[model samples]
Target: MLRSTGSSALNFGEAQGANTDKDYINKASISLKEFKESRVNLKILSKVDYGNASRRVELLDELEQLIRIIATIIKNKK
Candidate 1:
């Protein structure tokens, strides 16, 4: 969802300023979760039989790529 997609990025920004390793890791985990949720939303949107399919699919692709990039960041945060 929009909330998750945006929240993930927001959480990541907050994590950057985290004062402890645990805080950083926690926030990154939250971000990763949101990213996954966003992916789910986009996937569901893609399956809808009505509405703007082309535009929805394109947006889904973009969101999926964004989630993937965020996932990479989370995985590399050690």
Candidate 2:
């Protein structure tokens, strides 16, 4: 899950310099999928008693905000 988030951040960083709007949107979409994976993993961790539930929930909230921001970027891309 850490690897997933790290790689997604890297992908998003690369997307920052995309040569075209379409390319940026495509890469951002991939990052969004990866973020979703992390979100699900966090839920699993909570269900299995793997971590502090409160902290995990907080992380989920942060991830949700990030997902929304990325989705909005994709939606408004021209």
Candidate 3:
């Protein structure tokens, strides 16, 4: 999932034209949505199991940060 986001960001950076930038932006947007869904699923899983809760929390935090970064990128691009 992170890989997809990174790939999209890289492609966006390397884009040669406005059309290419829009395409990569859409890809990044989709990746953001998927990441958000994964965050929700992780939250549910954590609620179901107390073991490794701290690690799960850390991951959730990282995912949220990534989401924010991607959102900012998309906003600035538009």
Ranking by TM-score: 2, 1, 3
Candidate 3 TM-score versus the reference: 0.72
lDDT of 2 at 48: 95
In model 2, which runs have C-alpha deviations exceeding 4 angstroms?
none
lDDT of 3 by residue, 1-78 (tens): 345445545544544344666776776677677667767777777978855888888888988997898789788878
My TM-score estimates for the predictions, one after another, are 0.75, 0.95, 0.72
Choose 1 or 2, whichever is better by lDDT.
2
Per-model CA lDDT versus the true structure: 0.81, 0.91, 0.70
Candidate 3 collision pairs: none
- Each prediction's total of clashing residue pairs, residues at least 3 apart in sequence or on different chains, is 0, 0, 0
Per-residue lDDT tens digits for candidate 2, residues 41-78, read 88889889897888988999999999999999999995
- Candidate achieving higher lDDT, 2 or 3: 2
How are the candidates ranked when ordered by lDDT, highest leading? 2, 1, 3
The per-residue C-alpha lDDT of model 2 at residue 45 equals 91
